[model samples]
Target: MMEQNQSGRSLLKQMTLREKIGQMLLCGFHGTEASGDIERLLTEVPIGGVIYFARNVESPEQVERLSKGLQHIARGRGNLPLWISIDQEGGMVARITEGISLMPGQMAIAAAGSLEDAYEAARISGLELKSMGINMNFAPVLDINNNPANPVIGVRSFGEEPEAVAEFGVHTIRGLQDACLAATAKHFPGHGDTDIDSHLDLPVIAHGRERVERVELVPFRAAIAAGVDAMMSAHIYFPALEPQRLPVTLSPAVLSGLLRKELGYEGLIVTDCMEMDAIAVHYGTVEAAVMAVEAGADLVLISHTAKLQRESFGALVQAVESGRISEKRIDESVLRLLTYKAKRGLLRMDADEPAAVAGREKDNAMSLAAAAPEQAERVERGDRSHLDVARRISENSITLVRDEEGMLPLKLERTLVITVATEVTTIADEQLVQAPTLGSALADCGLEVVDLTVSPEDVASDSARLLQAAEAEGVKQIVVGTYNAVNPSGDPQRRLIGRLNRLGKPVAVVALRSPYDLLAIPDASVYVAAYESRPLAMQSIARALTGQIPFAGKLPVSLK
Candidate 1:
């Protein structure tokens, strides 16, 4: 191990200026395959890494092929092994959806209230990602979702409590690292209290250092203590941390001073995509990439636009040549990059070692087949074991907020199920699996069901029609699923529930997204919080409603 580490440092000393600059960049590109611009970047510019989005993924086989092809290209050019990364944070933020374990979101895991579950979910996710040749996962969001009004980090967060978030986040980090995949605890100093999405515009946290320390920085401290491999910077501004109101990604005070010196984190510091509006709209993409590196980010990520990627590479090269940014600073980052790669056993296969590269690929395939044969088989068949784990967690996470009128265990033979169509609440959420209608699950429980799906905008106009349909059918029980109904636009859903109450039928409301929906509709006689609108969650909700499974989940966040 000592010799390997020394060799990595020795290799860094032999690198050219452009090669050292490339080590600081992690770029993204279009298409499912690595060709054209992506191939050119690998051969000429020789970027350090690549991040996968929904656009770059199709299936496990395709992803494996793409990852292997990219690594081959980099190796062919006598460059270091590429860091193939992805945002497989589970739930709505997942990139590789098909043929993998789709674990419950962070909030759902918290609601389940088991640290073991959190660890297992991440371990499973890490193993599968490793099988596909993805070395790093930008995951285990350390943000505590303290603000009910937060648009981006709601379900992605573990919970509102600092300690609970810390415990779960650390366990997730351990799980991923134990599986030999790097886990990134993200969005520091915190993104949990903002209503605005950084993908759209800059958000600010104006709290003093004391308050920020108490809430926002708790999970991050715990993550650092756990030896997390990477930390992704947030685009949100922290007034207390940086007086200039710059995003944390570009603020030296926040990234270098606070995170590095104060917190004592020695891991790789990666910036969130430079193309995000919070950075790009305010500062040019090429400029922000340079600023992020200057701010102490070891890796500057540009997730879209190949033109900007090339420009940013050239700009960084020029920055070093012109003495705007010292070559020594570039070498510092490259050294860190090489060290991390060496630690991960990524530096063993040099360009001359084709047999070693082929052996590594064979090892990955054999490990997948031997260790997780069931998982591999499930990829070809249906109903993966990981889904069973996901379903079990979902079942445990179904919180019975209230059942005032004793409406649970649906006594009626026939029921009416009303569901609101789901929308992508934030740019982070891909909404891969449609939340299956509750009617089918309920029907499987022996209740005759009538299903109705309504758009959020048309709910008010269609309320009367729904009521008439319910009355004409003589339905005595109604179950409605609400998705993020705490927002101002959810007034129609609130009013629709009010109208349904007057019909004299037992109305049970299930919050399919945010658990805070009951806070907006306090008059609801029977309310439940499913925490998410995914298929497993919906099925779990259906089971809980019929008493097939008990509501074991406790509220991770306060309803008040």
Candidate 2:
């Protein structure tokens, strides 16, 4: 370890100022293929890493080729291996979903009440991401979802209880790291308990230091104790931590004083994207990038906008040249990055071939072997095993919130499954591709189903028409799926449920996204919480509704 540290420092010393500045940047581009602007950025700027979003992903083969191609570009530039990162947190936040294992979100995992399930789910996700050449995962959200109205981090969080979030989060960190994929415990100190999303506007956490430590910082402390590889700083402001009301991403008091000194965190401190509205709209992107590094962030991520990416890199270079930010401080972060890369076997300065330095010779051989017919068959068979784990987690996370009128296990031959179309709630959540609706899942379960899809705006405006539709003569039972009906926008969905209760048809309300929907539609005969609207959760909900499996999940958050 000591020799490795010295070697990393030696490599750090050999870096030019521009190369050192590039090491602090993690950028993103806009393409499925890497031949355009991304190629130029990698060659000219030599960014330390790249983040993959939904737009950059198409299929398993395309993703593998993209990741490998990006690393090859970095190698050609004589740079260390690039950190290929993705937000594969499963559920709605997953970027690569088609061929990879899609596990439940943190809330769903906590709802299942199994620490082993949490660990196993993360392990599966990590292994699959590693197979696709992704080295870092921005995942295992450490936020505690205590607020019911939080738009962005509802089901992304583990649970409301601090201790549960801490325990479950630690297990997930261990799983991802053990799989040889760097796990990032994120949106620190916490993005929960705020109604606003940092992607749009800055949210403030006004809690005192005591409450913040007790609730918000619980999981983060646990993650640090577990030796998590990285942490993504939140853009939310904490009045108790920083007096200036600046987002934590650019606050020296929070990032330097609180996280570095008080917490004694030695790993990388990565800022959430600098282009987010919390920073971009308020502080400007290039200015925030310099402040983030000055604030003790080891990496400043500027995902999207190559113009901003180039400008931020140049701005950091100027900050160092002007002596506003010391070269020693810059070297500190580069050394940390080098040390981490070396520890992960992603750096070997003594090697002549960059492929050997990146340990990609074996990966290249494996890629070739994967082209063989038998290897493809083996890969398909392995995917099944991972899918089963995902299915089990989804099944265990199906919470039967209520059945006061005993309307479960629908005995009716024909049922009306009314599903509200899910809107992209936040920038962090992907626009789901052919997300299975509750009606389709019910149809799969052998019900004579009449399916109706309504948007929240339409439901809010045309509740009577929806009610008339639900009152169709042959439909004996009504199953309505609500996506975050607790929001004021979902009043029409809540009203439609109330009107459906008057029809004498048994009403079973399924909370697809947020479990707190039951709080608004209290009179529904039955209520079930699926936590997410993803395909696996829909399948589990369908099975649980048909009595094929019992609802074994406990509520991870308070609905009352």
Highest-scoring model, TM-score? 2
Clashing pairs in 1: none
Clashes of each: 0, 0
**Which pairs clash (backbone N, Cα, C closer than 3 Å) in model 2?**
none
Candidate 2, residue 224: lDDT: 94
What TM-score number comes out for model 1?
A: 0.93
lDDT of 2 by residue, 1-560 (tens): 46556766656655678988898999989998878999999878968899999999999789888987887777766666788888888887899878778888988999999999899989888777777778789998999999988989999999899999999999999999877788999999999899998999999999999999888999999999999989999999999999997999999999889998999988999999999999999999999999999999999999999999999999999999999999999999988887776655566535333232223342211011111111111234138888888899899999987898888897747898888887887899865775778999989999899988887778877776677777778888989999889997888888888888888888899998889888888787699998988888888999999999999999989977
Q: Which candidate achieves the best lDDT against the true structure?
A: 2
Cα-based lDDT for every prediction: 0.83, 0.85
- Which run of 10 residues does model 1 get worst, by summed lDDT? 364-373
List residue ranges in candidate 2 displaced over 4 A: 349-382, 461-465
